[model samples]
Target: MHGEQMAEEFPVVGLDTDAREAAELLASQRLPGLIVADENGAPYTVLPASQVVRFLVPSYVQDDPSLARVIDESLADQVADKLAGVSVRALLPKELAELPVVNHDDTVLEIAAIMARLRCPLVAVVKDRKIIGAVSASRLLEVAMTPH
Candidate 1:
């Protein structure tokens, strides 16, 4: 099957979207990641759940994860405040990874290769440089595993 056949309607956010709202969407939907779009609504970058977790964790705690154990739950509750006025752009890494994308007609194997190579959980399926839909890693595996 091709990308268009496998792609599903997925949630997408823009670079200027509120980080808190994005995180809530991820949590509420239990998404592996959120697809981010540029000003033109084209595929930009993926904001993985893991990346959001990383952003929430204190830098010092990240440096020494054991410190996380000592931090009180109250502080943890307040930690979300950090994202209050932050934009999705602020949460993104300084050096961006290649956008995981596939053409509507790209073979399933091609989509798999891009997902594996980039370690991204979701890939945008585009037609004419605009996003049509997204294919998740689980969906790709499910399709690959199905008997022909």
Candidate 2:
């Protein structure tokens, strides 16, 4: 199937949007993920809520007062702090193969192959070499169920 036909309306968050807001939006929308856009409305990074959780939750496992204090903070503050020292670029997958994306006319089989090969939950669908929407793994499965 073509990427345009396979593409579904995907949620987006601006770079200026705080991580907490982004996290909350993800939860509220029940989306598989969100596409982070730049100031010019260009796709920058695709962030999963799982990654947001990872960014917020402390990595250490201890019973120290300092750690406890840190963990007791609000989600917004916690997310802001995490983002203070980080950028969207840092969260991107190291290899392009790991960052699944498809052109507007790409077939469903091609998308499925990329998703499987890259272990991505969704693949961005590009129109005119720009991200317009995404095709989730579930969506791909739905299409595959129908005989061509």
Top-TM-score structure, candidate number: 1
Per-candidate clashes, comma-separated? 0, 2
By lDDT, who's the top model here? 1
Per-residue CA lDDT of model 2 for 48-130, tens digit only, reads 66666665555562334366565644654655466554555455446434456788889888888888886767878888767
Local accuracy of candidate 1 as per-residue lDDT tens digits, 1-148: 9999999999999999999999999999999999999998988999899999999998999999999899999999898899999999999999998988899999988999999999999899999998889999999999999999
Residue pairs whose backbone atoms clash in candidate 2: 1-107, 1-108
Worst 10 residues of 2 by lDDT: 56-65
Per-residue lDDT for 125 in model 2? 86
In order, the Cα lDDT scores of the candidates are 0.93, 0.72
Name model 1 segments beyond 4 Å from true. Answer: none
